[model samples]
Target: MANLVIASNTKAMKKLDKGTKDKVWAFIEKLSADHTASGLHIEPLNAAVDPRVRTGRVDLHFRAILFKIDDKLGDDPTFIYMGTWPHDEANKLAERSRLRVNPINGVLEGIIGELDGEDDRKKRTVVPDPRGELDRAIKSQPKSYLAERFSLADLTERLGLEPDLAERAYAASDEDTLLDIAANAVGWQGSALLDLATGLHIDTIREKHGFTDSPVDDTLDEDEQILKALEQPASKMQFTFVEDDEELRRVIEGGDFAAWRTFLHPEQRKYVEQNHSGAFRLSGGAGTGKTVVAIHRARSLALSDPTARIVLTTYNKTLAADLKAALLTLDPNAVIADRLGEPGIYVGGIDALGNAALNQAGNIADAAENVLGYRGAELTHNRTSADKVWRDVVQSVSSGLDAKLATPGFLENEYVAVILANKVTTLEQYAKVARPGRGVRLSRPQRIAVWKLVEAYRRQSRMDGSLSFPEILALAAEQLRLRAEANQGFFADHVLVDEAQDLHATHWALLRNLVAEGSNDLFIAEDSHQRIYGQPVVLSRFGIKIVGRARRLTLNYRTTAQNLHFAVSILSGAEYKDLEQGEESTDEYRSARLGPNPRLLECDNAADELDKVADKVREWLGAEVDPATIAVLTRGQTDRTQFVRALGERGVDARALDNNPATVGHVQVLTMHRSKGMEFSRVILAGIDDTHVPSAATLRAVPEEERAEALLRERSLLYVAASRARDELVVTWSGKRSELIHSEAGE
Candidate 1:
């Protein structure tokens, strides 16, 4: 006499308001009483509605009843809409219909009823269910005992069936009847039932249950058969190469140039044809297939000698991933593994490779200990005493100067500026100038004063017990020198460096030690034009050949010819003088067209300028450009607060790229220094005025020789900013024009 009670909106049932709960209870009670009166034996219709539906456009409602004698009701828990025609349209349809079930669920139940309506409803068919069939099947075959071991309670709960019904279904005498009950219990049909049949070795049920078997095994072959099947496809490795003897014949035989272009760069193709290598270095621009040629070269070397493993290495993980992807495209069967902290066919990063070499020689630990000890000594009391002796001499020089010129405040200010500028260099030089024999010695008070200033400078720069960048380089060089002197050639088979132009003198010395014999083991690729970092490579001092054997690629493919031309014209160098058009036509590509003509907007103040910038972003969104493509390039993070705040006010999706700890977000407001090697569809170089563009923060401590170089780097950064706009470039300045814009504009 068990009956089911179906509930809707169960999630919100516990949180329903008191009044609504009461009404819902009353409705259920009335339905239950009506069901009993209709000659259906019934228990209480236990129903509940989610409180979330109270505020919803439609209310929670449903109708249910218990039935005896197993009368065919088409589908159980069927939904019916009881509202009269048009007047109730404005009202919640669910509430007005009385049975406030989700329309989608109601429609599904109705469709299922329609599907079942065509069946023979009068014939009360019954079969020996799953449990009886499984028991009999398992008993006849000892090997099939695993089927009988299944937990009946667990299966009943899993299938959401009554215990007796589940047991009867599981123990059916006929496998076909058991399978139908199993499929129905699990709500599976078609491919799912086929999967079940495959797992259980029950394929005969396919014919009995009137289910068609889909041919899914056509593409899937067993691994053992793969080698044997390859015999059928004999010409899979066939390839066509251009005949150098007949250039005209090859042009006549046409195929996709894009695929060929991927393997052969113009210079590399020429080099391969000639088969010559002197002191040549390929200086291909970023994305110019430098890595492709490197892989081809490595593969060619490997082909020449199967035993001679070629080592390929790059500066970082991203480059390593790129190189690995390129190699896989060339030869999918080739074995490629990471060379992290170890030597392999392919290694990565100069630091990693160097460390690997040191580790192999069993000297890394000793070298690290030596360097740490030397650094530690500088912070010791004995070292401080030695440093104080020099400080006293500096005070004597300052105290001897005329009182009018060397007043305490004036001397302090000048010394502080000089210290900040030179840092390590000036301190070492000042010690030489203030040697012990230098006559007019300092008084005790003056000695203490100078020592105070020196200590203050050291503390300010975080140089109390730590090595400077230059000192770290010097120590690393010393270790390499020591190793070289011991005749321990701890060298890599090959060395590859990225950002080569930024390497300092000591770094070049380390590179020299890495490839001591100069046996074509070193590959360096760099552009002097993009040397934005102040540290320039002093190639002459490193004892390397300086022939013009380096490959120079000048084509700018990332940006359109118009943008490229503008960038080269504006940047202060002859390096980018010969600007050429990119491979693809800029006009055809809608995403990479010249956007709004560059504008130099002048504003009354920073606040007014931010408001205008915010308005521009809103207008762009109105025009249907994605917010993700837009970026605001500023001088620094501190200067971008007003602009970012204004954008927020206007409900624009904007973020300060400098402030974002991780590299994410769509709309970015970034500093010029942080915007290198990154691009955007629409770039806005904001705060580009005389005062703001080259602010005191950027120009103050930079040396004279480095100023032009820094400005050139800044120009490169500007180029990077301008080129980021695939479709558009916008330059906004305030007050007086920036030197760069004024020079470029010829004003």
Candidate 2:
């Protein structure tokens, strides 16, 4: 049977008119049923670059290029590229194109024009042209001063480029043109070369692109290779079959070629398609498609086992909603939708899942009254106010321990970061526990004193029916453990976790208990660089081991290069550890698109800053950017209210984000913490002045010994906010600029 596949890169689709798109769909439907249908005018071109290449006439002036699989041409033609081009140009493009399976990840890719210089040199027959300057420089040195001697073949293999292009790159005698060549290189080749040029480690580059030193299978026949290609998921392929008319309409209407819609990076696809013996995790920086992997994994599991019950969850509700929507978009047959919220598959916030599991086990009333300490309807009305309980606990502890020691904030840090974080309940465990990353040392006497204060606080809070978020999670985890001790089976067959960094240790424990330990038990997607929430629990603490099953994504598809550089600079100097205890940073992460630097505005005061913000919002709205696609974020809740009121006063329709809507005519206003897992086309971060950012209250609340961790949290918060902007970032501040902003300027 013939298959109609959309090309991996959909940029060509954006240039078509609605009438032409309709024609393309009609042709696809006919082609799917009968490739030899009359009036289609499909014929092989004599001058095509590759022997298997052919062209189909879309209309009088346009053409679609197709790459047929070996001798199986008529039956399995893959549409790789389509657009309005002159007949000669279309043929040339087809002639130059080459199809090869990437050795690293076993993915089939179509490339236009071999990277070798022979073909290009043929077009421009000027002998010893000025462009040869770069080629000549490399000839003189043979070895680069920045790194070891790399031959053309080595470069081609490492970058997955054709030998000619690699040769042309080596021929470059000047750095400027070589830089330009690196910039123009498409797909992973450009990213790899840029990283190499920027002094990133060779091993790091190889790992990022899924390159390995191990030998690949060189004996597979062409037929065998094509069969393998057919098995690969759409997320990892550049060319895909749209299959149905509804899917084709979605493709044309979605605008820019969305990777989320058509393809997945190899690493992401691996987690989706491959099964694990135990727990597995996918880790990467922002925009690396971690959530995309989690969504696909959920659907994949459901499709593989119809009787399987799957739980897809994340830390926050807004992100969970986003995940659910994306899952539905990927679900063409409604397989996931029909099973969602049922016994087959479930999707929601982790807290929601926890509550559901507790309710199912008939422990909800006791959990509400005892574990969470709520009375009557307060259990329903005041459920999400657990964070406030933690704050109140901090205040009470700070005042109680003030007379014993100068700064008592470390006690709160110890109680949460050490005790509650590790599920430590008894005072003996608290006194002997090793506080990694806490930076404060306490004698046994001091530990006892701190324990006395914390114990009193806990007892009084229990009497008052108060519980912090972490405490609730810990309690929930204990409930699950109790159920398990009674030999109760796990609630679900599989659990997939997104935004895992924001989750507390207790949350992981609850998740660990929700699914039985076996193949495909846990799928975690996390990036510590984007950890705005202060819960940094080691995964192994909850018996969730991912030693050899962890993967990292390096390609950034969301933000522009300039914007990424600025966002990364904001996170400079702070070290973040991943769930596996590995040092994580976005230092080597690169972006495909480049844009103007983010604007950093220094205003006279709050009034002037709000006026400037209004002007920027008005400009973005005028540019046809969707109002909902634009966001205004702040460091504090008070600042969020001020910005929301100011935007409303300026006649801009804006709403504070309690939840991110599917579509909106109003702008979103949110605190930096709330904006963690979301993305926007344009973002305006206001009120980041020195005093407001690391608020005086926050500083005074923490002991001097624990100030470094607190400061890093604030920096991470800013990094999260800045990274949420995909295309443009406008940072405004009044009075003294933040030290963090100054640090960014330095980077």
Candidate 3:
């Protein structure tokens, strides 16, 4: 008797149509219970280049290519389901494809084509190196990191890895080396790497791939061995396996990216399960699976202790809702807590946490005033909300001052970044505190004048009984600190922050007090290049230290190769910083997949752009692509509204994405900001006109000296929109295109 294992979702399985998929599902369901050659049309393929390669009839016309492997220790054989195809195509595929263990890394991989050097590629043992280190140390080898350290000949032997992918990965140069040597090496060395560079120093690749963590048990059947590797994804990794019949169905019916939630890239899985002494930061470019790690991190914590008091939070209510949804998707049966510091996982926006804590403090206004260092300060009950509320205060207080110093933007920056950030209540403290990241310096008299504006803004907020979101966070942090000092409040055991780059300093202060300082207190995920809001603040300034515990994810799980290059070029010449105030690295990053170059359509006006958008949408729909997977992102609410109206007139039935479920029947439209933490199969960034992008109103408010910095944020916003596209992207503009848009590298 032999065992049957449905290898987890593959690109091949995803392409099968419904009728064939249903048949394949029925075939596997029967095979799992009874894998007899008679019950199922299973037989050896005489045409296959390798005798072990076989074909099994899924239905009358469809046949699945099954790779048969005998247990290494001589036990029952195992049948692995590769994919389903037409009977004729399945025979052609089995004729050329063979599964073999890489002599260098000892990882099993499937390959097509002839082996160039049959004698040179000697088999290596499955035992890993004793170093027990990550691949980061592999880069010490210098030029052509992997090529210099390991034999490229042995790497391409047995045709395990494509020769071109190996050449590009090991080749030397400033531009081609966009992907980091270590990140790319380990990234591809796993199941994903069987298609790329598969050769590395045996000692390094073995240890890096988790062989050192635990050696493979050869006495067990091959199916059991692979199951162990996949189950222990963090400690030891190999294949993507579907353990049950339901997962097989999920793989067979691919859409909504459900399979991705179950199968993680090994590199991402490492971060999800790694431990650190204090705060740890995992930052990566858009689509590198940072959010994926955040979701799994919550589950890992809760599974370790069901009552761990884990709070998974983000910047806004929308993103928090998304996180909560994703957390539930990861584990639907787990109980979600109703309040902060409760058992199980609690997902919510940081501001919501502040409101809840303040409400629990008996009197919200009293808690806020005390945190402001103005206890007994007259406060009103009205809560009016507004952005940049310092224009009138600056105009009325700063006389004979430089116009740049008196702008509402500059004054607001001083008030939020320095005064409130430092909890300074008096004008003397404000005048003496240092202002970092502020372009223009201020004289003592000028500081005194700015202090008056800050005071007035605070006074106005109090009178209206409205505290800014930052003020709410500051107040919440104060309450947490006071309660912790008395050792009474039940605080979070672990706090995981996603979209960390957009959080204000006060947000970090509250998070710092939410969890006690110990091992694995905080796990942060962010990408500064995707930061669309909130100014950058140093994490250490708020006492959340991440000095030595940080890792950058360099492999992208979304975005095509061509679109990634285009999106990255938009960030050319811009500098970004990490939470520790260190320069962020954007190089050595690589795309996991490739697609057609992003389309740049220039037009006469927005009407013409919308016309072209409708044409593309109609064309994609005609081809049977799911409408729910198509998105049209815009620069503003105005453009979002126009997209919906214009597409409806064109008979596309486009709908704007809101809190409701309008996902299936219509193409979705959304402002770029609303599109964060989301992905689509196809995207059209419509109406990127000059006047709309880097919106004139936004730049008009900034001081002249800091315009460059403001311009960087705008580029980041565009990059964020471009990378949301997973398979294809089309950028359209009217009149003159935004100066921020850069031509593709080759163009």
Candidate 4:
């Protein structure tokens, strides 16, 4: 009997037809049970670097490559599943491919040197390239290639990259060339080359690949010592033993990196498995696996105790729905409760959870009266009603206050950021509280006037019978605090929050109070650049401190390097902050994926733009890209309607995906705001023109002092939409483009 393990870097293995994959798994299972099975037809390869390397028949079309590890102790046998390939390809692969413990770095790796007839692929890759390989080469002089930046000696001696593979990567003058090299590379070599080509620091690469500062050891250098080599930290990321049928099936079904829920990079796994003392914050640019970490953290907690009351939440119900779906995807057996305060996992919007908790306590009106000065207003999650209340209050107080100070934006910001945040119930407390992040300064008189305006807004909201979401959060927080003080159990044993940046101060207070303050009390994921709602949250003020417990993910797994650059450009010139007030940087972030630089389609008018969107979508469909995986995002709902009508007229079925799950046979069209928490293989950011982006009507509504922040939020709105793209991003506009998007190429 032998222990069989699946190699982690099996991109080709994942692409097999489901029928072939099932047979491949069966082949491994049979081989593991009895390596000398007569019908298996496992034959040793004479051309292999390691004599034990062999190919076993998976079927007539495919052969499985396996490495037999002979334990020095004469223990039970062990085997490695290199992957399944066509008969000739498998035989050829066994000849050149060899697993070894890098003499210089100690990391175990596999190299597939120039396979038979690979020169044709070297000349031109089938990968998506807008420009041909020759043009891509011309765009890059030798100085720009990874070879020029890194010496061959460093690649070999330091990183232990196979010499021939290193040379192929060295001559890669363009991203497409690197893509070709990466495609041909096997196992760890493939991932390392792509990361190096993108200009990631060499030392960081060493650390990521499990290389340490210790001097090299010549004692354990044999390739035959496969069992010992598999124990290396590098091998930990690349190989996992196949103990059962389900594990093997899950492995062969999904591609590398695409199966983020299953395959976490070593760095990411550390965060998922590590323990934190108190509240922990994980921040990253878009696509950097912040949400992935959050979901896994929730899973880890639930797996620890299926009965531990755990609540996994995000900014809104739409995002919460996505999180719930992802939670199940990660673990189908996970228990998801339909309501809050349950013993199993409860995934919902943070405010929704708070409202539910308050309702469970059986006195929503009384709770509102205790926190807010009144109980008449009903809690409303509707943003429209909240905005209208702010507008009416501002209009009512316009005569007594300065025009700049009477704006609804300014008033609502003060009420949420200062009044509700600090629990200032009196005029004196409002006058005494500091307003650090607010754009405007207020004197004692101005503070009194602002307090009067907030009072009026509350009174009007009561008369209108509509309480804003933030007010409901305030009520919930006050009630939860009282319960905890009187020795009531927390709402949940653990709480996890994704997209923490968009939460208002009151929301944070409620979340902090929802779970008792202890280890793993709060796990927060946010990208400050994605803050399109409310004021920047200062966590300490809300009694949730993350002083030292913080981690950041720098590698993006979703969008290509090209699309990420385009999305990051939209965030240029805006200063972003973390959960704390410290600055958040997007400078060092890198994506392993590569593709065509973002494309821009400029039109003369909105009507013309809609037609072009349809044509471009048709072009994509003609290329065999899945229609369901393409998204066209608009700046407003009106644009969403026009695109839908235009696509329908052109005979392309398009659905307006408004917080709804995607369906088959239609391309999804969403507003930029609605596109949050959703991603597509191809995305078209429609209506990124000067008028629609900044929303000429929006800026006028913002007060003079707060215009800059409002404009930054507008930029963030587009950033969120653009980053939702996974492979290709296309920008389309009717008139002059928004100044936020610079005219430059990426990747």
Candidate closest to the true structure, highest lDDT: 4
lDDT over C-alpha atoms for residue 322 of model 1: 54
Off by over 4 Å in 1: 1-264, 268-280, 284-341, 344-465, 484-487, 573-599, 619-626, 640-642, 658-665, 703-706, 742-747
Off by over 4 Å in 2: 10-14, 70-149, 157-160, 167-183, 198-237, 241-249, 256-258, 332-343, 363-400, 403-471, 648-653, 660-663, 743-747
Q: Write the per-residue lDDT of candidate 2 for residues 1-747, one digit (tens) a residue.
A: 465656644232226677777666566566666777876676776765566667777777666767665435434655444343445556666676656665544545565542244433222111122235534544664554332646554564454444445656666655444545665654555556666655566566666555645423567676457546545442244555666767766775664344576666555666678889999988877787788888888888887888788888998777788878888887755455333335556888887776566555545444444433342312231343433444455566643444424233455556657776565656677777887766667777777767766665666665565555555565666666667777977777889999888776568878988877889899998888777665477888788988798877766778876777777887777887898888886755766566567899989889999999999999999999999999999888888888889999998888887565634788999888888778999998898888977766786666676677677778888888888888898889989988777545422
As a TM-score, model 1 comes out at 0.47
Local distance difference test values of all predictions, in order:
0.41, 0.68, 0.71, 0.77
Tens-place lDDT per residue, model 1, 4-108, is 122211111123344544443443344323433332222222221211111111123322211111223432221111111121221222221111111111100
Number of clashes in every candidate structure? 15, 21, 4, 0
List where candidate 3 sits over 4 angstroms from the true fold. Answer: 1-5, 9-15, 19-100, 110-151, 154-238, 241-258, 361-370, 376-382, 388-403, 658-662
Ranking by TM-score: 4, 2, 3, 1
TM-score of each: 0.47, 0.82, 0.81, 0.88
RMSD in Å for all candidates:
26.6, 5.4, 6.7, 5.7
As a TM-score, model 3 comes out at: 0.81
Clash pairs (backbone) in predicted model 4? none
Candidate 3 CA-lDDT value: 0.71
